[model samples]
Target: MTAPDETQAIRLSKRLAADLGCSRREAELYIEGGWVQVDGRLAEEPGLRVRPDQQVQLQSGARAEEAPPVTLLLHKPPGYEAGLGGIEPGAHASRSRGAPEALTLLQPDSLHAEGGPPVRVLQRHFRQLQCHTPLPTEASGLVVYTQDRRMARRLAEDIETLEQECIVQVTGRIADGGLQRLCHGLEFNGRALPPIKVSWQSEQRLRFALKGIRPGQVPAMCAAVGLSVVALKRLRIGRVALAPLAEGQWRYLRPWERF
Candidate 1:
């Protein structure tokens, strides 16, 4: 008995559930798995709004067979390659002599102590995950790897724009005005480098928060300011900070967490 033209749009998951005789959760799963079509186009967001008259159809033979994508946060220890290529400083003698694979660090014991919901690890989960940023093998901090293509694409596209904060331990005298030059006046690869925020954490430690950083750029930046980088460890990326994750350990990125 609803009045004509008075039916407001409802959530797509709700509409799909009512139309397809399934639970709202199932509808959401279907939508996220690319099995639901809205007006002949695939709809991925379960929270999308749908008009009463809009067409919503479940693709024939559509099933949520694929496992959900996963993201992992690892506290990379010095020695292991963040992606590929680099020697593992502390690898077991039994391990093959080559660049240590980061995946080996993702052991069950390495999971966060206050673990959230239990997640079963499948071989497929590790198959095609793409690492977002590559930390140098000599440095250690948080590293991200994900199986979500959308998330991967976003990170790849915005990498140069995202700010990364690092703590660098150094040795040597800092020249007068050296800190100012490090903050503003610098060049990399024959081009003017972007401005960075640099500060002293301690007598021998410097804090740097910068964007568009290149591989080996941190060392080069320190060298420019009359500091020799003894060690460097990333502490933050975007809004995500490296918490108390133990070195060489990893944990599943919570569903609610975002970089």
Candidate 2:
């Protein structure tokens, strides 16, 4: 890479703006969108310094428009933090030793083969993402993270009304009428719980569909009924289902898909 001379160096966005007769912000958008090339190499930083003699060009069919924000649906595995929550991307320096974060899996290689309709993966898409409806670190299944503000708002606002589906594996015997009590007459944190749908999926597995669930509530509910939760996995939140997504992989949320 050629370092620009201190006396003759100029910011890339400034030069591009002058060359294209456009605003600096537009030039920055073009550069950040991966449209600008400096000396035959892609220049993604608008503040990069360049000399007048260096070759500078825009990619063919380039436009000075901002890229659309994106949302990601991840099949989070157990033992990984579901939300960013003060953790750094790809690193857990601030967290307890050996505690990994699921956000680190949002890399190009981890993108599911059928990760929804084809969409270009950009570095910016990984930044500023906000995780919603966090799952417990000990449990695993579908988790959502998004950069779109409108989608974030929808998830936040509809949290109480939207139903969440979880598949819980339990052990030990249940008290008589325990399943019925689980459907209603349950309390968490000294507060009365609303009636929810619960059914036996198998001899050891139970399917629970409820709204506004709190962390640790499932296990508490099971304990109250003389059942011990052995494993738990969330399968869906509202209309989005986690099927077809392998564990430790992720896909893009479809455009028409809504919570």
Candidate 3:
């Protein structure tokens, strides 16, 4: 639960989303139904945020649901698209491509239904990458895509967003001051970005756990610390990682996959 004024700090709920003129349910309905976003990703948490800075534009003439809620884990290479490839930058064009063979295809996999007004698919889609905040272009490992909305939404979207793992390659040693700054000195706009857990995995390799993120955040973070992002690949979203999948591939999100 969050107060309207507090919208600037965290997730927003259903009633709150309607307050912003979005739709029902925070994750899928609000976002899949079309318009809503936090920091930039299609707004998933209804009560996720209502901050003036948080964009809440309803997709005009958004289509109604036609599939059952679902989730997927895609080994998104440098080139593939994330969700429906919207106005977001990188999706339009990129170098590497991903495989979507893992997911159950465009077929609907219903997760829930009832005598309620209408049933909705809580599809949660993702693209794996090096930067926690991928450039509108840079690319890498696993990307999630799907039609089973609910479970997917829960896994991907939430105030309690799951911890994501990243493997990064950088060019040069980080400055003592810059590394320190990387740990806690940057801010998006004037809003303080989330704190991160950063460490070295090798001479030119580093690992980071961003407590929070702004879309396209990681690349900027590296630049701020004077590090060039040479390559980035995501390992996991929550407990879900790109284990069995190969590059540019996808698979059905199993019932056991939710984090």
Task: Pick the lDDT winner.
Answer: 2
lDDT of 3 by residue, 111-176 (tens): 212212133333333322111212222456655554444544443444135666777888865666
Supply every candidate's count of residue pairs whose N, Cα or C atoms clash at under 3 angstroms: 0, 0, 43
TM-score of decoy 1: 0.67
Q: What is the lDDT of residue 86 in candidate 2?
A: 22
Task: Tell me which residue pairs clash in candidate 1.
Answer: none
Per-residue accuracy of model 2 over 1-259 as CA lDDT, tens digit each: 9665678989999999999999999999999888889989988889999988988999998988888888999998878887632221111123344768889988878888876534666677789988866766667889899999999898877876888898999998998999999999999889999998999999899999998776567888999999998888889989999988899988889888888
Weakest ten-residue segment in model 1 by summed lDDT:
85-94
> Could you arrange the candidates by lDDT from highest to lowest?
2, 1, 3
TM-scores of all candidate predictions against the true structure:
0.67, 0.82, 0.51
Rank candidates by TM-score, best first: 2, 1, 3
lDDT tens readout by residue for model 1, 1-259: 7554535888999999999898888888778776788889878788888888789999887775556788888888877777532222111123334657676787666778865523555444565778767776777887888888998898777767888898899999988899998899888778888788999999999999988776567778778878898887878888887886878777777777677
Which candidate model has the greater TM-score, 1 or 3? Answer: 1
TM-score of 3: 0.51
